[model samples]
Target: MEKLQSPARDIHPDTRNGLHPVTLLNRNNLTLLDTGTSAEQFLQQKISNNIAQGHQDAFYVADLGDIKQKHWRFMKELPRVKPFYAVKCNSTNEVLQMLATLGTGFDCASMGEIDMVLRMGVPAADIVYANPCKQVSHIKYAAAHGVCKMTFDCEAELFKIAAFHPKAEMILRIATDDRDAWCALSSKYGALVEQCEDLLKTAKNLNIQVIGVSFHTGSGCKNTHSFCKAIEDARKVFEIGKKLGYQMRLLDIGGGFSGNSEFRPTFEEFADVIRQSLNQYFPNNKEVEIISEPGRYYVESAFTVALNIITKKEVYEKGADGNSRRKFSYILNDGVYGTFLDFYLVKEKQKLKPLLGKDFATEQELFPSNLWGPTCTNVDKLVNEFYLPELETGDWVIFPNMGAYSISMSTTFNGFPQPKVYFVLSKGDE
Candidate 1:
């Protein structure tokens, strides 16, 4: 119940803009511009105009206003569970600054992320070192930065923390049913429930304070029962800590919440499941504070990518029945080695559609085309087989729900330049 003091520092200058920075193009730059439609529409129009002007590069449109709406929804639906926006999801300075102003905390995996949040004027208490296994140097960094809350799943991590950050408050990360999680982290992180008591006992013996229990049901989890099971497991761990004379006041139901269009169980539906589980498990435990690390849920829907078609080719393929078929290959400016790494990491299929042209209605012939990235590697394929109207050179392809994982996981592989981000501000956002 005490107010945690933020370290004194100068406010981030960009925060004055109250949003992420973007190349705000006016009517002269993008004549098809109209603020009335959604950001996706604006991006599509912008990309189309750029292609006509001989611009063949990939870019992203981040709607800061839309991000604010997502934050608002989280506050409305899961009021009891405070969200520490997973910084790794989309650590754009604008996004981080915006979330910080909205009073959201951060879940940082590395010292660089923790440093970024701290330098942005966020309180140390608002940041959690959520990675269960950490380098000793990072532990020293967290300790030096006053980030006392951290997670550990093994005795070795405990010894490292106790040596480098003896005063740090620790959270035991237990494994969950991550089989149904999109990115199952239990294999790498989290201690077994049976081993949790021994971990807590080890912490007690080391004179280290075990203050909370944490578990991630994995990212993009499809099963709602996963939440119930994890929460129930956390309850058992809390009792273990209590019996050991430790005050386990924090419960970090680690991130696995999803917002992908392909992901089943909508955000609201997941929230319903989580809320019910929390009520059933921790209803009378008002003294305990509950928090979550939600990476994709906050940023996924706020991003749209506009990739230009670099080149295309048509090939005749013979079937086993002796029927010849026309197969089309379209190479894009961005691929798996770049901003679309999620395809390689999680096999997530991104939705792609061409810009609807004036002649699109008249030309109704569709072709089976494979989308590939502009890389030498053949594995840079995006869409395996998508039925769409024939696309010409310089045409634009629009991908939605790309705010999370895309930018953060992008690389400079094959010498392709990273896409420039353009922040689209809705009317009255200023």
Candidate 2:
């Protein structure tokens, strides 16, 4: 294969320090703050501004600085692995631009995502078409765009790539024991470890270049043993490829790390295990390049969303003791079809509770409340039986860790607009 010649640039200088500083300019006003300012202060001021202006629609405030902190931490731990930000996680312009400027690679799964990344002037070399199963047209598009880095699991995909993008540097995605994962993905993707030999051998027969191996311990994986086992399995595949005259470089440990700190084996613990496993299995680290496709780790906590109660209804039911038991159901501008999708789609039951954005009377009674979305669907409930103080229409409810899978997965199911997003960077809050 010819040497890739994407216009490579130096990583932004801000990355060297603890505070990754970058001026954020977006549709929502950017609040550049001093080192003393905090994310709470930014949210407090923005929520106040929106309320004062009678803005009842739900919206988001993103602390771009938090993303920088995450990036700095990512490099600090597991220094050998490079991050290819999963564009599907939060593909907003502000996010794409900031990460691109920070000099990290991209992991795109579809044609639209590929176009979005490349249109921003990101080099094709800095992209990995990580989706193992792809459309024929999408493969042609990648070939036309010089995106040779991609992945495959089945033999059909290998034949398709050989006929379409023959120069593709393919990564064989192997299956892992993700039974304990929050969202188990092995059932859908990943070729089993026992199947890797046949896949690699078949790739060579098809004149397809199998350059490396990749595996995902599922998103939000719980077992550290699964990670270690997967890495060890990858080493076995590497040996098989070498014997088949294939240079098994590039090991992509797909994202399963949590968006809120760490998934199962805490951040520090997972990092220690991964680092140690890499040392033990692929100790000649200089020979193989390492990369990860992290979606939530970068943006999960960085964005805060505020929603207003558009309407409210209180019902009183006769309890077993013949007492009136009231349950309040309040509707907000956004819901399952809008932003709180995981609840409806995956039944994830996220621990994401709403924080009262405004002060309530100390003596106000708290009741079991049900949150409903503005959509016409009956299943658009944000949470079932949440406790909250009696709130009037227009009262603000804020939620953190709203960045991942919220914006990218939201749809205008009932023609309701997606929440507006504000990007800000505070000098102090890392």
Error of 1 at 116 (Å): 1.0
**TM value for model 1:** 0.88
Any idea what lDDT model 2 has? 0.81
Off by over 4 Å in 2: 1-37, 262-264, 361-363
| Weakest lDDT window of 10 consecutive positions for candidate 2 | 4-13
User: Residue 188 of model 1: what lDDT?
Assistant: 91
Q: Which residue segments of model 1 deviate by more than 4 Å?
A: 1-37, 348-359, 427-430
**TM-score list, all predictions:** 0.88, 0.90
Worst 10 residues of 1 by lDDT: 4-13
RMSD (Cα, Å) for all candidates, in order, is: 9.8, 9.4
Per-residue lDDT tens digits of candidate 2, residues 152-198?
88988998998899899999999999998877888989998789889
